[model samples]
Target: MRRVLGLLVVVFVAIVCAGRDLYEVLGISRDASSPEIKKAFRKLSLKLHPDKNPGDDEAAKKFAEVASAYEVLSDTEKRKKYDMYGEDGLKEGGGGGHDPFDIFSQFFGGGRQQRQQEPSRGNDVVVPLRVSLADLYNGKNIPVSMRRKVVCQHCHGKGAAHADDIQTCHECGGHGVKIETRRVGPGFIQQFQTTCNKCGGKGKIITSTCPVCGGHKTNFGDVEFDVDVEKGMQDGQEVEFEHYADEFADRSAGHVRFRITTTPHELFSRDGDDLWMDMNISLKEALVGFKKNFVHMDGRIVEVNRNEITEPSQVITLKDEGMPKYQYASEKGKNYFTSRLLILCIGQLNIKINVQFPDTLSAEQKQGFRELFAM
Candidate 1:
C-alpha cells in the first residue's frame, strides 16, 4: 500500500508544479543544445499533453508551459532573446510561436490539416486464474507469468539509431497524406487522396533500424504480475491489469484481463458465497449433549456442538461465517461478509427405530437398555 501511495505521489509531482522556471520545467540546463531541447520537449509533452490527459486542466496548463519553453529554446533567434531578456524577450521576439498541440503534431508529423489522434491500444490478453474456494473466501495474491510484446529497450521504440537519422518521406514530403489527380476525359480530372506508401503513412522512415526488434519497435518478453483475488470473488469474474498487454512504439499498451476460476473442494461444497458440509451424530450423542471439533480451510479448528435431537438431512446455518463482502457494507459502520455456512445434520437415532431388536443381548445389557428407555 505504501508503495502504491508513493507511486501516486511521484505522478502528482511530475504533473503539477509551483511556477518553476522554463529550463527547470524541461529539466534541462540553460546550456542544453537544440537537439537536447527537442528531446526533452517531446518526452514531457507526450506525458502532459491535453490529448493524453484529457479533462485534466493542470496537466494541460503544464503542457503549455513545456511547449512554450521548447518554442523559445528550439529557435536560434528566440533562444538568444530568451537567454538575454527571458520570457518577456520571447514575447517581443515573436508572437507565442504556435499552439502546443500544433507544435507537437508538427514535430511528429508536419502538416496543418491534422487528423484527430486517438491513443492506440493493443489487443487485450485474457487468461484463466485457478484458485481454491478457500483462497477466494479468505482472499490472496497469486503471481502470474505472461508472455507479451514490450517496447524495444535498445532504441526506446524509435526504431532508429538517432533521431536525426530519420528521413522525410520522398513521395508525400512529410505530409503523410497524398493527393492524386486522375484523367477522366478531355481537360477533366478527378481528385483523390491516399496514404504515402514510401513511409507506410508515418511520413518518415528510419535510416537505421533497431537491431533488437528489427525495426518492429517491439520485443517479445515474459513479465510477471500479481493477481489479487479479492474476498468474495465470483467465478468467471474478470480482474483487469491495466496497461500490461502488448506495447508498441508511440502507442498505449492494452490491458490484461484475468478470469477467476474457483476449484472444487472435496470436503466442502460451495453455493454462491456460502459453504456447505455434512455432519453425522451417534444415537446417544444426538439424544443428549455432544461437541466436536471441525478443521477449517486455513487449518483453524472450530467447535461444532449440538444438544437437541438431530434429524436426517437437517440444515444448520451459521451467520457471518461465510465469505467477505466485496466493497459491500452491512451497515454504516460494520463491514459484512457475503458468504456463510449450511451444515446438514444426519441423526443416528432415527435409524434405530426401524432396526430389529438384538436377541444376543446379555441380562446386564438388557437391564441397561430398559433403564435408558425408561428415562
Candidate 2:
C-alpha cells in the first residue's frame, strides 16, 4: 500500500529537471518512438541474450542495461517523468520497475513455457557433401537422396491403420512419462520422471497396427533433397535443412546439415572463396600477342587478349570472377554485409603466367632468338 501511495504522491509532485541517460545506453535519440526503442532493444537482446552469452557476467550486465532502457522508454508516463526529472524522479517514484532477467526472458524464450507439451526435436544429422570448385564458382544445386528416419506415410505417425484403435494408456493417464518419488534420507525425498513401462513412453497404444510400418511410428526411408551450392561458401560450412533429418511421433523433425567438402577442380584452385589458375603461354605468344575466350565455371566466356611482353609470374586479375558470395551475407543485420563489388576483393580470380620454351631451337629460330636477345 505504501509503495503505491508513495509512487502516486511522487508522480503528482514531480516537476522539471534533467533527463535519464537510458537513451544513450540504447543508442537512440531522446525523441525515439516505441518502434525505434524496440528495434534497439531487440538488437541488444540478440547479442546479449543469456543463451547466446551464457555464464558471462559482462554480457549479463550489458543485457540488464538494455532491459532497463526498454523498461523506461516503453512506458509513456515513466518516460515523460524520466525525461523531466531523471534518476531522481525514479527514486522519488519509489523504484517500482521490471526485473531485467524477467524482461529478457519474455523477449527471448518466455512464451514457450505457456505452450502445451512441446515436441522434442530429433538429433541433427550431419553429413559431408563433396563438391567441386566449379560448383562453388557457378552456384549449382545438386540433388541428393539420403535414407533417413521419417514418419510413416501409411499411418501418418499414428502407427495404426484405424485411428479409432488408438487408445490412451491408463497407467500414465495420457502422459508419456511416469513420475515417482524416492526417499533420499531422513525427511528428504527426490522425484523424477521416466518413460512409462506400459505404453513404452508413447501416450497412446494402437490395437490394430498399420500393415506397412508394423507398430513403430517411424521408418527408415529415402528422403530426397537438393543442396544449393552457393558461390564462395567455405569448405566445411554447414548447409542446413530444418526438420528434414529424423522423425518421431508427435515430435518435431531434426535438421539435416551438410558439411561441404570440395573436390580438386581441374581448372581452378580455391582459397577462402577466391580462385587462382595458371595460364601457360608459349614464347612466341608471350612476346607477340594472343587473344582467346576462356570458359568460366558458369559456362560464360571471359575474353582475354594479351598484347604486351609477358613476365614469367605476371598475374591477370578479373574482377568478380572469383566465387559468388555465400548467402549468409544477405541474412544477418540489415545491410551488414555490403560488398564494394568494384573494389578488388573476394570473387576476383587471379590467373598467373607460366611461360614455356622449346627443348631444342631450330637454326632459324635460334638465330632469331639470338637477334632478339641482342636487341
Q: In candidate 1, what are the lDDT values of residues 230-338, reduced to their tens digit?
A: 6667788766665678988887787788998889877666666566776666656656746866676667786766677655456666555555544322212232311
Q: Report the C-alpha displacement of residue 225, candidate 1, in angstroms.
A: 1.6
State which candidate has the highest lDDT.
2
All candidates: TM-score = 0.56, 0.54
Query: Can you tell me which runs of candidate 1 are displaced by over 4 Å?
Result: 1-119, 283-289, 328-375
Report the C-alpha displacement of residue 213, candidate 1, in angstroms: 1.0
Report how far residue 129 has shifted in candidate 2, in Å.
3.4
For candidate 1, the lDDT comes to 0.66
